[model samples]
Structures are given as C-alpha cells and as structure tokens.
Target: MRAFLKKEWLEWSRTGRFLVLLLVFTVFGIMNPALAKLTPWLVEIMSESLTDMGLVASEVTVDAMDSWVQFYKNIPMALIIFVLVCSGSFTGEYEKGTFIPVVTKGLSRRKILAAKALLLYGMWTVMYGLCFGITYGYNEYFWDNSIAGHLFAAAACTWLFGVWVIGLLICFSAFAKSSSQVLLGTGGVAMGVYLLGMFPKLASFLPAKLMEGLALLQQVCEVEDYIASAVTSGLLVFLCMCMAVVCFDRKQL
Candidate 1:
C-alpha cells in the first residue's frame, strides 16, 4: 500500500493536479479575505451607478463571516475540478488497457479502488488544510476571529461532500468504459443533487446541505441541523465505495 500510494502521489505530481490544487486553494485563501474586504467597496461603486437608475443598493457589511461565505460559495468550482481529476483515475487505465497487467500480476482490484478514493480525499485534506490555515490567518488579521462554535464541524461537512464526489468518481470509473462516460455520470449526478436542493423539505436531509453549511459556520444555523445531512453524506460515500468495489470486481480487465 505504501508503494501504491507513493506511485499515485508521483503520478499526481507529474500530471500537475497537485500543483493546481495547491495554487487554486492558495489563491482562494487569499481571495476570501481580499474579497470580503473589497465587497463593501464594490457595492459602493455600483451603488452610485444604480442610484441613477432608481435602484437602491442595499447595505452590505464585510466581516469574518464573509470570508467563510467566499469559501463556501467557491466550493462548486473546486468540486467540478475534483470530479474531472478523479474521474479519469481508472477509466484511463481501463481505456488504455494499462490496468490489466496490474490485475494480472495479482494486485487486487479492490485495493486499487480504495487507494484511489482515499488518496483523492487525502489530497483534498491537504489542500483544504492549507486553504483553511491561510484564510483563518487573514480573517484574524483583517477582522475579529472570534467565530461561533462548531466551525470545524461545519467545515467537515463540506469535506465530507468532497468524499462523496470522490466515491462517485471511483464508482463511475469502475463501471464506465471511457473517461468521458465517467465524467458525465458523476457530473449528471451532481447536477441532479443541485436540482433536488431547491426543495426545502428534502434539502435538509440531503448531502447537498453539506456544501451549504456556511450558515452553520456563521452560527445562524444550529449545529444540530447538520446532523442528518452529515449522516446522509457519509452513507452515500460508503455506498459508493462499496458499489465501486463490487462493480470493479466483476468488470473484465
């Protein structure tokens, strides 16, 4: 497993996804605070132009919570890139027949799938840690950092959402014949989830709420409100991982 993980890390570095995630998160870290600081100015700039058109600009305040808002608002972009990067893990190998030799050499297919999903989560963990660290530092310096409780729990909700994405990518990669199919399958499911989130009753129980937990970070929503969503997200991840293993075990190498 150590060797497999090392190989995966090396490949990720060679492919530049490592650097890309690092840089993207770093920029987001900086942008969160900068945007929070600038949003009031931006609204002011637009306020004058809009006043002439009989439209009044609402009062907007920048604060520590705004930084969290930036982080959550930008999560979709991060997840989209994550899906693209992870969807090709096994599909490309299968398409090029590159995975056959590994299976034939007695390396377990289950191990490969587990490693891929775990490593993807591991990558997210690292990038998110860096992003969180920088954003926290700036938030402290720029504004009062005395945030509400359960912020880490709220953050974990989104990270759990990323796990679901990885699980789906691996699941689709295990079953799809091509990388495009893998991408489409995962993307379609994500779109479906977003659409479902529009329904309030269902939204509270869905994993989609995991991505929307910024309110929890702001203490506007209670931590208890996220318990169901977190549970649902975790169950989805487990189901996807299990399904991927089962399907991959049956697939012809």
Candidate 2:
C-alpha cells in the first residue's frame, strides 16, 4: 500500500495538474471572501445606475454567511473541474497499456485501487484545508471572529460530500472503459441522488443537504438537522469505496 501510494504521488507530481488544481481552488477560497465583501458595493453601484435610468432599487445586504455560501456553492463547480481533470487518472493508463507493467509485477489490484482512493482523498483534503484557512483568515481580518455556531459543521458536511463524490467517481470509473464515460456516469449518479433529495421529507436523510442546507447552519437549523445527512453521506462513501474495490477486482485490465 505504501509503495502504491508513493507511485501515485510520483505520477501526480510529474503531471503537475495537482499543483494547478491547488492554485485554482485556493483562488476560489480567496475570491469567496472578497466577493462577500464586495457584493454590497457592487449592488449599490448597480442601484445607482438604475436610479440614473429613473428606476428604483431596494435595500441589499451582505454578511459573513454570504461569504461561506459563496465558498460552498463554488466548491461544487471546482469539484467538477477537478473530476474532469482526474477522470483519466486510471483510464488513460489502461488505454495506453501502461498499467500492465505495474500490474504484471504482482501489485495487488486492491492495493492499486486503495492507493488511488487515498491519494485523491488526500488531495481533496489538502485543497479544502487551504480554502478554509484562507477563508477563515480573511473572515477574521475583515469580519467578526465569532462565526455562526453551525458554520464549521456546514463546512465539515461539504467536505464529506466531496469525499462521497470521489468515491462515486472511483466506482463509476471501474465500469467505464473511457474517461468521459466515467465522468458522465458519476455525474449522473450524483444528480440522480440530488434530485431524489429534493423531496421535502428527504432533506434530513440526503447527502444533498451537505451541499445545500449545511451552508445555512448558521441560520435556523439545529445541529441534528445536519447530523443525519452527514452520517448518511459517510455510509454512502464507504459503500462506494467497497463497490469500487469489488468492481475493479473483477474487472479485466
């Protein structure tokens, strides 16, 4: 497992795409706070322009919660870009017959799957940490230090949602012969789950709550509101990982 992880790191480093992702996501982190700060000003400017046109504008407001909202909302888009870039991580090697040498050398397929999962999860965690560190730093510098009690819980929920996403990708990739197929399959599954979560009663049990409702934790939600979703997502992530292992083990490479 250690050697497989090292190999994965080596591969990731040589490509440098990971570095690019880090830079982009960190910018999103920085941008979230900046936008939160600037939104009111932008709205005022628009309002003024409207006034010049003999139109009226209502009051607009911006707050720390808005900053975090931008953070969580932007993350899904960032994750999509990350997935697109990484979808080829395994499939590309398979297509080029590059993994044959490594697999033929008696590397356990389970280890390979585990290594990839671990590496990607680590990357996601690092990127998330960088984002949150910057966001918190800026929030402290420009806003009140006391965040809404549930903000951290919200962030934690989103982080777990991202893990579930990665797990889904891994499982889908096992059945997909091409990178595009893997991405489409994973995206479809995620969207399907999200749609199902839209039923009013399912909010408490759905992972989509992690992405949507968690951001509002500072508002009216009790801690228990997010607890169920978090637990469900954790279970889904485990199931997805196990499925990936089983599918890849039976897959002819």
TM-score of each model, in listed order: 0.89, 0.92
Give lDDT tens digits, candidate 2, residues 147-243.
5557777777788888888888889877679998999898998899899887989878988888864335566776677788889888999998888
Per-residue accuracy of model 1 over 130-205 as CA lDDT, tens digit each: 8878888999898876774567887788888887777788888888998899888988997798789899999988
Q: Model 2 clash pairs?
A: none
RMSD of each: 2.3, 1.9
Angstrom error of the Cα, residue 64, model 1: value is 1.0
lDDT of 1: 0.82
117 Cα displacement, candidate 1 (Å):
1.7
- Runs of candidate 1 with Cα error greater than 4 angstroms are 41-61, 147-149
